[model samples]
Target: MAVLPIVITGEPVLHTPAAPVTTIDDDLRSLVDDMFETMEAAPGVGLAAPQVGVGLRVFVYGWIDDDDVEHRGVAINPELWLSPLSTAPLHEMAESEGCLSVPGERYPLRRAHRVILRATDLEGEPYEVAAEGWLARIFQHEYDHLDGVLYVDRLDHTNAKTAAKAVKRAGWGTPGLSWMPGVDDLEG
Candidate 1:
């Protein structure tokens, strides 16, 4: 498996809704493998297909829970259900989020603390995961990519403006921009 170039913000694929993964062929498996590698290299808990320039409803995630349990897998054409988010004030860094597509920028945004993620596995089997805490956030973040949404897009007025400025300063306001994980000295 190889680390693929992760598309930056403003890329059409990142903004357009991804198509469902209909055929579970060897090629799709290979892409899953590469996505895992890319995610590892990106040092991110999750990575979505559109972020890697593939317009498919797929994403890979790897995270260790507070109990020392490891959760890692690929979600193909996944559907997610989330619990209501708290209206309480965000705890600065504790509630902030970042994205591989919009690298190196993070801002506070409220998200459901729990989520139910359902999707097919690599072997064409269906499965569901009940996740909470950071894992839940990861699922929501990646799922948003499939629907052509980014975390920055959900930011409030002040944060949204700041995120846009960050994107502009990073020279990522246009299309056709990408960064190769493990090669590019950057992080999300």
Candidate 2:
């Protein structure tokens, strides 16, 4: 499997909702494998297909729980259910998250503390996961990508304004922007 170049925020594919994966063939399996490799190499907990310029509803995640139980899998054509977000203020360091597409930045955004993720696997079998804590956050973050929503977009007024400035400063916020994981010095 290869580590694909991850597209940046202004890329049209990332801002648009992804298409469903109706066929699970070798090509899809290979894409999943490559996504895993890319996510690992990017040193990110999760990744979505749209981030890699593939407008398909698929994502890969890998995270180890506090008990050291590893959670890793591909979610194809996923349907996610989230608990109501707490109206309480963001916990800053605890709630801040980074996105590979946004690159080199983390912002505090409120999110549900629990979620249920249901989807098919590479083997074309259905499965579900009930998650809380960081794993749940990962699922929500990646799921947002499938819906064409970036974490920065959900940031509060202050952070959102700052993020917009940063995006402009970096010469992003346009199409045809991408970076190779291992090859680029930037990481998010």
Candidate 3:
């Protein structure tokens, strides 16, 4: 598996909705494997297809603690289902968040304390998983990318301003604040 180059902020693709994956074929499996490797290489908690320039509804991540075992894998066409608070498991909102596409920055975005997801594995097997805490937040964050939403978009105005300054200074424009793909001129 290869560690793919993550598409940074300012790219038009990140702003647009990602394509859905209809086939769970060999190619799809390979892409998932590569994504896992890429995520590990970058030492990140999650990675999405859009981050690697593949505008498909796919992502991979796992719950790993200080233990050496790094449980990791991929999710295809992931759909999140937030459990009802009444019968659902209890959860707590954790804020610290980051994105591969955004790069060199992190932000605090409020995310559900817990969540349930229905998705297919790389081999096309269906699975349902319930996660909470940081795992839940990470999955939610990556899933947002599949919908063309970035963590920055979820950041509070004050936090967003912090990122905006960094983005402007770095001069990265693929998926960050400075670039808008369809909008020829943002300031009319």
Predicted structure with the largest lDDT when compared to the true one: 2
RMSD of 1: 1.0
User: For every candidate structure, what is the RMSD over all alpha carbons to the true structure, in angstroms?
Assistant: 1.0, 0.9, 7.3
Candidate 1 residue lDDT tens string, 14-53: 8899999989999999999999999999889999999989
Considering TM-score, which of the candidate structures 2 and 3 is the better prediction for this target? 2
Query: Model 3 Cα displacement at 35 (Å)?
Result: 0.6
- Candidate 1 least-lDDT 10 residues: 179-188
Give the Cα lDDT of each candidate: 0.93, 0.94, 0.75
Q: What would the per-residue lDDT of candidate 2 be over residues 59-120, giving only the tens digit for each residue?
A: 99999888999999999999999999898877999999999999998888888999999999
Give the worst 10-residue stretch by lDDT in candidate 3.
179-188
Q: Identify the runs in model 1 with alpha carbons over 4 angstroms from their true place.
A: none
lDDT tens digits by residue: candidate 3, 61-99? 965755565556678888998644343422223366667
TM-score of 3: 0.82
lDDT of candidate model 2 versus the reference: 0.94
